[model samples]
Target: MNADRARGAGAVRSPSTATFLSFLWPGLGQWYLGRNRLALVYGLPVVAVALAALWQLNGGLADLAIQLFAPSFSLTVLVLIVLLGVWRLISMADAFTAAPLRTKSSRRPTTLFAVLALLAVIGHAAAGFYAWSFYQAGSKMFVAGLGGDFNSVAPGASGSGTSGDLVAKPGATPATADSRINILLTGVDSSVGRNHALNDTIIVASVDPKSRHVVMLSFPRDIAGFPLWNGGTFSGKINSLMTYAGLHKDQFPDGPLPSLIKELGYLLGVPIHYYAAVDLDGFRTLIDKVGGIDINNPRAIDDPDYGGWTDGRPLGFSLSAGVHHLDGQSALAYARSRKGNGDNDFTRARRQQQLLVALARKLTDPSMLTRLPDLLAAASQTVRTNFPADRLSEMLSLSRQVKDDAIQKYVLGPPYALRSTDATTYSLKLDLAKLSALSIKLFGADSRYAANAPASPSKSP
Candidate 1:
C-alpha cells in the first residue's frame, strides 16, 4: 500500500511540473518527462519557424517592418501568427496529457496552466492586430493597376473606363525593364475650400539600382509654354495640369493624374514607371509622425504674405539661416513659402528636396519601430502610390546602399528654363534643347534623344 501511495505522489508531481515546463517553451515538459521523440516533434517545428523568421529578416527588423506595408506579406504574417498561437497551445496540452495523472485534488496546477494559456492568447492577438493594421494601410496607399502604360487610352475616350482597361499604345515606351527605375513624386495642394487639387510639387526620382546612384529632377510649378504629349502647348501653370486635364477629359482620356504623368515623362524623355502623389496636409502629418525633421537653411526665410496652408491660418513663416529643427507646420512653410525675400519656386523646390532626404533618413532609423503604427496610419491618409508593394523590400535594401554623395539634384530653373512674359502672365519657357542634352547626359541610352546623339556614359557625381 505504501509503494502504491509513493507512486501516486510521484505521478501527481509529474503533472504539475511538466505542465509548468511546457508553459515556458513548447515541448519542454515532454522533454522533462523523458518523452524524447515527442519532445522533438513539438519543439523542432517551433525552432524551424523561428529560424525562418530570422532568414526573412535579411535586411534587419527595420526593413522587415517596412515590408509589412505590403498587403500580401502582411496577410501572410497574420495567418502565420494565428497558426503559431495554435501550435503553442497544442504543444502545452500535449505535454500535460503525456504526464502521469494526479490522484489527489489540486487546483494550483490547473490554475497555472490556464494563466499561461491566457497570456499566449493575448500575445498572439496583439500581433495579429498589428499585422491587420499594416494590411489596411498598404491597401489604401497602393492603388492597383495605377502603373499601367502612360498613353494607353486615346483622347476623348469614355471617362468611365478603369485603370485596368489601359493598354499600351504602339510606339509608346514600355515601362523600363532595365537597371534604371523612374518614379514621379508630386505634392498635391488640397483643402476644404479648394475646388481642385493642384500638384504644387513635381519631382522625378531616377535611380540606378546597379550603381546605387539617384538623380532627382525638380520641375517648377510655374513651368508653362511647354509642349504636351499630344503635340499641343500648355499656357497655364504646370501645377494646374491635373485639374485641367480632369475637367477636359474629352482632350485627356486617361484621366487627370495619368495625363500629367504621361506629359512629364514625354518632357523628360524617359519612361516614368511609377508615381506617388502626396496631399500637402498629409505631408505635414507625416512629418509630425516622424517627430519633425532637421534641415540646414542656406538662407533666411521671412514670408510676410504666407497663408499657412498647413496650419489653416494666416500665420506667416520666418526662420534664420543655419541648422534648424522644424515641426510639420514650419517644414511645410519652408517647402511652400515663395513670398520671402529672394525666395521663388526654384528655391522652394530645393528646400522640398532637402525635406525629402531628411524624412527618409528619419524613417529608416531603428527607433521608428515604436512609432510604426502611427506612421503607417499617416502614410495611408497622406500618400497614394502606384509603386509595387511587393518590391518594397528590394527598394528598402537599395535605399540603404545609396549614399548622399551619389545623389545628384537638379532644379529646371535659370539656364534650363528661361523666364518668359510672352503669355498674359509670367511663366517659365522650357529650353527643350538644353533639357534634351541634360537628359542624354543623365540617362545615356535610356533618353529618347539618344538615337541622334552619341550616348554618353552616365557617371555618379
Candidate 2:
C-alpha cells in the first residue's frame, strides 16, 4: 500500500502493480485485478499450445494439418495472433489505472478460473499432440514411392558388382540410375456421391535415368476405344475400366489399377511396371493447401453442354486463350475441362499432361521449398501407388534433369487406335504392332509385352 493509504481513512490504490502483473503474463494482471475467471480463460491455451508445439513438431498434429483431408489453420493463427496482441494491450491499460485490487475470497470464484486454466492447457496440448502426429505421418507419406516388376527376360549384364542375378541393358536398366521406367498416372472419379468409378485422366509417364528424359503418354476419356484390361476386351472408352473393376475388387485383390495398367501396357506396347491412381477430391484439396498453381489454360469456344451438362444446366465455364495462375477449383477445371474448344479426349489428356508438367516445374522453385511438407502430404493423400520413397527421390532428381518442352506426349486416338464398327459404338481398337515397337524402345523388352502384333502407325485423335 502507498503512504496515502497507510495514513488516511480512505485512499485510492495505484494501478502500476496491476500493469506490471499483466505485462508479465496475459491473464495474471486480470487475476490481480480480481477478474480471475477471465484471466484463466486467456492465459492457459497459449502456454499449453506453445509448449506442446515445441515438443512434438513432427507428430500427428502436424500430419493432420498437412494432410489433404485436414483443415488449414494458417489464417486462424494470423487472426489469433492479432487478438493476443490487442488483449495484452487492454490488460496493460486496465492494470495501470485500476485500483490496487483486494477482493474478499467470497467475492470471486477461485475454482472456476483454475478449472478453466487447466482445461485450456489440456485442450491446446491435445491440439499440439495431434499436429505433431499428423506431421510425422505426413512426412512418411511424402517420401513414399510406387513400383512394379514384370516377367521380363533379365538383361544381359548385372548392376556394378553383382549381389545376385541382376539384369543389365545396353544403356541403362530400370534398376540402374541410367535405365528407364514407365508408369501410368491415372486420375479416377470415384467419390461416394458419384456412385461410379470413372477414369477421368490417363497419363503414361516414362522416366529415363540414362538420358534424363521424362515422356508422357496421354489417353482421352471419351475416345471410342473398347476397354482392354484383364487380357479381355469390353465396350466403351478405356476410362470406363474402373467401374467394371470396382464391381470386382473382391475377385482381384490387387485392385483394378494393376489390371488397368496391364491393359494400357498392351495398348501402348510398353512394359508397364508401376501405376498411381489419385482421386479428384484429394487432388483439389492438395492443390488448395499449397496455395495453388499458375497454369496457362486457353480455349476458344464455350460449350453449353460440356461433359453432358449435368442436370440439364450448362456448366457456365468459358475461357479465352491466355495464361493464368490457378487456385484449387480453377486447377480442377483446367484438368477436367474438355467440353467446348479442346480436341476431344486426346486433347484433354494432353492438357492434363500440361498441368502435370507445370506442377513438376513449380515444385523445384526455391519459394516452394517452405511448402514442401504440405505439398508432399497432400500428394500422399491424393495418390496411392507401388512406387517407393527412394524412387520418388529419383523422380525428383529426374524432374530436375529433364526440361519441360523435352517431355513429348503420346496420345491414343485415331492412328494407333481404330474405330470398331460394331452394333455398339465407342469401340476403339489398338494397333498392337506400332505400340509394341514403341514400348520396347521406351521401356525395354519384357516378356509380358514381347513386342506383340503386326507393325502399325499410332492413331491421332
Candidate 3:
C-alpha cells in the first residue's frame, strides 16, 4: 500500500499548473508535461517571429509606429496579433490536455484555464483595435490624386502656351531619391460664417533627403502680381487662385487644389510632389490632443481689432512679449492676428512656423505615447496629406535626426516680397530674380533656373 501511494503521488501533475506555465510562454506548459517535441513545435515559431520583429524594428519603436501608418503593414500586424492569440490559447489547451488530470479540485483548474484564455483574447483584441485605427487613418491621409496630374506641364514649359492652355505631359515618373521633395502645406479657414474655404496660410516644405536638410517657405495670402504657370501674370491675391480655378474648371482642368499646387511649384522653381492641408478649426483639436505648445513671443501682441471668427473669442487676442504657453485657441489667434501693433502677415507667418515647431516637439515627447490614439484621431479629422505612406518611417527617422538650427524658415516677406498697392487694392509682389537666386542656392541643379545659371569663373593654370 505504501509503495503504490508513492507512485500515485509522483505521477500526479496539476493541469492548472501546466496551463499557467504555458500562459507565461508557448511550449513552457508542454515542457512541464515532458512533451519535448511538442514544446519545440510551439515555441520555435514564436521565437523566430520575435527575432524577425526586432530586426524590423532596428530603427526603433518610433520608426515602427510610423510604419504602422502604411495600411499593408498595419493589416499584417493585425493578422499576426490574431494568430499569436490563437497560438497562445492552443498551447495552453494542449498543456492542459497533456498534464495528468489530477488536482486538489478540477473546478479550479478549469476556471484558471478559462481566465487565461480570456486574457489572451482581450490583449490581442486591444492590439488589433489600435492597428485598425492606424490603417484607417493612413488610408485617409495618403490618398492618391489629391495633388492632380504630377506630369502636367508646369505653367511655363517653354512651348506651353499660357497657364490657361497647359497640357499634361505623359509618362512622367514620381520624384526620385536624387530629386528634392517639395510639399505644399496649407491651412484652410472654413468657418461657419464663411461661404467658401479660404486657404489663408500657405507654406511649402522643401526637403533634400541626401543632405537631410529642410526649408520652409511661407507665402502671404495677399501675394499678388506673380507670374502664372502659363506665360501670363496674375494680379489678384494668391489665396484666391484655388477657389477661382475650382469655379472655372473649364480653364483649369486640374481642379482647385492641384491648380494651386502647380502654380506654387512653378513659382518656387521646383516640382512640388505632395501637399498637406489642415482645417483651422480641426487644427485646434489636433493642438489640444497633443497638449498645448510653447512659443517665445518676440514682441507683445495687442490686436483689439482682431475678430476671432468661429473661435468664440471676440474680444481680440492680447499677449505680452516673453515665453508663453498657448492652448489651441490662443495659438490660432497668435498665428492669425494681423491687427496688432507692428503685426502683419509677415509676423503672423513667422509665428505660424514657431507654432509648427513647438507642436512637433510636443508630439514627439515620450509622455505623449499615452495620448497617441487621441492625437491620431484628431489628426485624421484635422489634416489630409498625399505623402507616400511607405516613406513615412524614413521621414520620421530623418526628422528626429534634424536639429532646430539646420531647418531654414522663410516668410517671403520684405526683401523677398515687396508690398504693393493700387487705388483699389494692396498686395505683396514677388521679386522673381531674387527668388530664382534663392532657389538656386537651395536646390543647385534641381532649380528650374539652373540652365540659365551663370557659368563659374575659369581657374588660372
Candidate 4:
C-alpha cells in the first residue's frame, strides 16, 4: 500500500496544483506534489519567521503593528521581510516547474492563478487607497492648525473664498540670533459644555540650539494685569490674555495668538520665537501615542474637581507620591489637578512643567520612531503651533542634545510671585525684581556658556 499508493499519488499531482499550494505556503506546493522532504526544506524557514513575528507581537495585533515599525526592530524585521519575499518566489517557481497532474482535475491551474492575481491586486489597491487617505487627512489637519485656512477673499477675487495654502507668518526672532530659541507652550482646557476655554498651562521654554540646553519657566494662569499688545493691560487673569484678545479681534487685527505672543514677550522681557498650543484633550492623545509618560510625583495629587467622562460623577482622582507611569488620562489629571492635597495653582503649574519634561524624555526615546505616525496624527488634531515644519531638523538636533539633568525649570511661585485675594478668586502678583533675576540667570547668558554651564540644576518647587 505504501510504495504503490505513493507512486499513483505522485502521478496524479499537477504542476499548477504544486504552484498554487506553494503560493499559499513556501513549501506547501512541494508537499502537495508528493515531495515531502522538499516541502519541509522550503517551508520551515518561512514558518519559523512567521512564528518569531507572532512572538514579537505577543501583546496583540495593534502592539505587533507598533513593534513592526518601531526603531528597535526595524533592521531585523526588514531583513526578515526580504528573506520571506525571496522564499515565496522560490516556492512559486518550484511549484510551477513540478510535473503535471495525470488524473482528472477539478479546477484548472490558470483559474487559480487568476484568482490569486485578482486578490493581490485588490489587497494592494486597498492598502494604497488607505495610505493616500491617511496622508491627505493628516496634511489637511496639519495645515488647518499650522496656519488659519483664511476664509477671506482670495487675492483678487471679490467674493469670500477659502484657501488651502498654509501661510505661516515668521515667528518672533530667536533670543540671540540662533544661540537660543524661546517658545510659548500653552495648554488650553476647552471641553464640552464650556463656552470659554482657559489657557490653564502656560510655559515659556528657552532652548539653546547649539547645545540643546533648555530652561522652562512656568507662569501661573491666575497672574493678572499683564500688559497686552494694545495699550490696555490684561485686567483679569493673565491666562485670559489670549481669550480676551480673541474676543476683541478689532483691537488685535493680526489674531489672538500673535497678540498674546507679543504680550507674553513683553511680560517675560524675552522675545518668544514661536508658540505651540495643545488642547487638553490633545495632551491625552499625545501621551498615549508615545506609550504614556513616566513622571516622579513629588507629592500626592488628589483632586475632588477632577472632571471625567463619567456621567455627572466626579473622578475623585489621586496619585501617590512616587514614580508612576501614567496613561493619557492619568497624566492629564496629574498635570491639572489642584485640589484635595492642599496644593494651590502654583503646585499645579509645577506639575505641568514636570509633565512637559517627562513628555520630552519619552519623545527623545529611540523607540518612538515606530510611534511617529500616531503621534503626528494626534498632533494634527490637538496642536496648533507657529513652529515651522521645514525647521524640524534643527528642532530634532536640539532635542537630541537635551540632557535630562540640564533642563532648568522655574515655576513662578512664592519668592517669585505673591498670592493675592481678588474678590472670590486667588491671583498671583509677579514680583518683578525676582522674576528679572531668574530670567537673567536662565536666558541672559551667552549661548555657548549657558548650554555647558556646570551649575547644578534647581529642584522644582
Candidate 5:
C-alpha cells in the first residue's frame, strides 16, 4: 500500500472511549485527542447558550426548561432545544469517529461507558419521579387549601342540602353560541389580628371555551339581602357569607363557600362552575416568588394601615403615581389599600381583579422558574379551591388560548350597582336588569337563567 494510504488507515484510540468522553462533556474527547482548537469549536457555543439561558432565568436553567411548555415562548424554546440537540449529536459523532494517533486510551472504555450509562439512567429516573411528586404535592395543596369551610353553614341557612343538589341540572346547556365557565376567586385576610377572614375580594372569571374570551366580574363586598339557599336571606354584608357559613356550620352542610357560590350565580344569572379562595397574607410570598409584578398606578395611593414600613412616615404604605414594580408586601398593600382616589370597596374590588391579571402575566415570565417551587409552596398553604385535579390540563389549555385583548372586565359597583344605605347599613343596590345585560354581553349566555337575561349592554363594562 502507498504511504499516504497507510497513514489514512492508521490505528486509532477506542471509539467507545471517545464517545463516552464527548457525552460527559461536549468536547472532552476532542481535548483528550490533543485537538484543543477543535474542542473549543465544539464546546464554546453550547456553553455560551447555556450561560445566556442561566442569566435570563436568574440562574434557573430548570425554569427555562419548564417555560418551554408555555405557548408564548414555544418558538424560541423550540429553536434552542433543536440547537442543543444538534450540537450534542455532532459532538458525539465527532468524538466517536475521530482518528486517534495513540495505540490505546488510559482508562478501560467498557467500564467507563457502563458507569456513565448507569448514572444517566438513574439520574433521569430520579428526575422524573421528583417532577411527578412535586406536581402531586402542589395539586393536593391547591385542592385542600382552596376548598372553603366544607361542613360549615351560614347563620339562618339550613344545612339540609348539598351543593350537588343546588347546582345547574344535569345536561343543562348554555343559552348563547358558546359555552362559558365561571370561576369564583375570593381573597380574604384571615391572619393574626383579624377576627374573621371576610372575603373582601370577590371575582367571577367568565371563560368562553369557543371564542377564548374572558370576562372578570368584580363583586363588591357590601351587597346585602341576597336570598340564600335552604330558605331565608343572607344577612349582613355579602362578603360575610363565608364567615357566617363557617361559624354556623349547621346551615351550610356542603360548606359556607357553596352558599356564596350559589348566591353569586343567582345575582349574576350565571352558573359558577368552580371557586378558589386565597389568603391575602400569602400574597406577598407569591409576588416575590414571581420576582414581583408591575402595575400602572394612575393615581397616588397613600394608606395609613398598609402594613409595615412606609418610608419613615406614619402612613404605613405609599405608592406614587405612574408605573411601579411591587414586591409581595407592596403589591399586597396596593391591592388592599382603599385610601387612594377612586379607592372604595368598589375600586378595591376592581384593583383586586387587575392584580390577578397582572400576577398571571408575571408568573408566565421566564425568570419565575427559580421561585416556582416557592410560589407553589405559598399557594399550597394560601389557596383553597374546589377546582378538581383532573381539570388542570384543561385549565392550562384554556389559559394559553385566551388572548389579552379579548378579556372584558366588569366591576359590579357604581353605574351597575349604586351604593345605597339599606335599613341596617350600606349596601350596593344592583340594577338587576342592567347587570344581567352586562353579564350576557361579557360572559356570553347563561344556562341557568337563559330566560332572565336582557339585551346586551350599550357599551363594554
Candidate 6:
C-alpha cells in the first residue's frame, strides 16, 4: 500500500485489548494486532511442545526411564508460556498505538531474531531439565541387588534390605524384625599378569538387617588344596579358584563363580544371596569418583617391586608417613600394593579396609549431596548391576548402617596363619577349621557389619 493509504488507515488508537489478549493466550493478541509474524513467533513452538507433551503422555517410555525425561519437558513449556506472554504483550502494544503497521519491513530481521532467540533459550532449558531429571530418576529408580527394597523378591514383605533395617523410632518399633541378607564379595586377580595370576581376592560379606551386625573375612590367595568347582581339589592360590571357574566353564558347569561361592558358603554355613564383582580398574575409578580417601599410617614406606604392572608400576607403593588423600587410581594402588615389609598382601588388605572406612565417613555428607549427581552419573554409565532400578533410595539410606569406626579388617598370615615351611613359593598357611569358625563369627547368620565394634579379619584357608 502507498504511504498516503497507510496514513489514512486509522487514527491509530492505543490497543487497550491487545495486552489483555496477550496476557490471556500470547499469540492471540499478536494476531489481533495484525502482526502474523509476531503471532507465529510465539505460536509455532507453543503448538509443537504441546503436541510433543501429548504424544509423550501416551506411554512411550514404560520400560525405559520415562519419568526422567517427562517432568523437565513440562517445565520447558511452562517457561515458554511466561516469556511469550511478555513479548507478545509488548510488541502488540507497539503495533496498535504507533501506526497502521509499518509499510516497510526493515525491522523484520530483528523481530525474527527475537522470536528465534526465545526458542533457543527455552530449548536449552528443556535440555538441561531433561538431563538433570535423568540422573534424579536414575538415582531413585536404580537398585543394586542387595540394596534394601528387595521386597519384590519376597511375596508380601518388602524384603530384608536397608529399608527393612530401619530401627524403630525412639518410642515405636518395627512391625517385625528384619531377616538376614548374605552376599559374597569376591575379587579375582584374573587380568593379564604374572606371579599369582587369576583368582586373587575372595571374601564373604554378610549382613543381618535386624541386628545391624556385619561380617567380612578374606580368603588367602594361595590357600592350597581348597575345593574347586569341579569334583576335585586344586593346589594353588585361592584367587586362582575364580580364574579356574572363568577359564574352565565347561568343567565347572554352574559357571566358575558358583563353585567358589559354594565353598565359601560351606565355610560360613550360610547361603550366599547376592554377588558384586569389580575389576581392579573400576575400584580405582570408584574411589576417585568419591573425591578420594584418607588413611593414617605413621611409618614411611617405600617398595618399588610391584609385579602386577608391566613397567615400574606399583604392585608396590611407597608413602611418606602420616595421613594422606587418595583419588580412585591412587587408592587402588594403595589397596593393591604389596611392597614394604609391613605392606605385603596382608598390609594391602588393611589398606583396603582403611580406604573403605574413609569413604564411609564422607559418602553422605552435605557436601557429598551436591556431588551425588555427578558421581552417580559417572557410576551409572560405567557400572553394571543386577540391582532393580527402583530401590536406590533404600540403598542410599541404608548406607548409613556402616560407620567409619565400625568397619572390620582381617588377614591370615604368620602366627594366626600357618605357611608350610616346606612349601616355599609365596604360599600362605591354611587353617581350615579355625578359619571356618572365624568365618562363622564374622559374616555368619547374623551380623550385618552395622556394628560399632571394629575388628581386623585374617585367614589362610
State the lDDT of candidate 5 residue by residue for 1-461, as single tens digits: 64434433555556686777777767877766556777898889879977876775772454444433333344454455555555666776687667453554344355555565555546545444434434544443334222344322111112222435554321123454345677888787666677766776889897877878788888887877666646787767788877777677787655566667777876777677666666677676777777788898877777766554333436566778898888887887778888655577766776787789898777656566556556656665665555554445455556766777888777888788886666566687777677766655554445344455445333422
Q: List model 4 lDDT by residue over 150-220, tens digit each.
A: 21101111121122212212264454546677788888777777687778888989787655678888888
- Candidate 4 lDDT (Cα, 0 to 1): 0.64
Ranking by lDDT: 1, 3, 4, 5, 2, 6
Model 1 lDDT tens row, 173-274: 335433688888888777668776778889999889877899999999989978887868988889888778777878876667677777787888887777
Q: Which whole-number lDDT from 0 to 100 does residue 427 have in model 5?
A: 82
Q: How many clashes in candidate 6?
A: 32
For each candidate, C-alpha RMSD in Å?
Answer: 5.0, 12.2, 6.1, 10.0, 9.2, 11.8
lDDT of model 3 at position 144: 56
Which residue pairs of candidate 4 clash?
14-101
Better of 1 and 4 by TM-score: 1
TM-score of each: 0.88, 0.58, 0.88, 0.64, 0.68, 0.58
Q: Candidate 4 deviates by what RMSD?
A: 10.0
**Predicted candidate 2 versus true structure: per-residue lDDT over 153-211, tens digit per residue:** 01111111111121211112256556568777878676556766677888878776666
Whole-model lDDT per candidate? 0.78, 0.55, 0.76, 0.64, 0.64, 0.50
Model 6 segments beyond 4 Å from truth? Answer: 1-177, 187-200, 228-231, 307-316, 369-382, 412-417, 421-424, 443-461
Model 6, span 1-461: residue lDDT tens: 74434434555422445544544455655666556666677667667766876774553333123244233433454465456445554554454443333445322334443454465447555555545655554543233333232112111212222211111111012123364555555443434544433544565555556545555656656667654323466666666665565466565443344455555555444556555444455456566777887788656667677544434454566778798887676666666777666666666666665665566565545466445555655544333333333333334445567554444556655544677665768676566566555654564423222132235433212
TM-score of 5: 0.68
| lDDT: the better of candidates 1 and 3 | 1
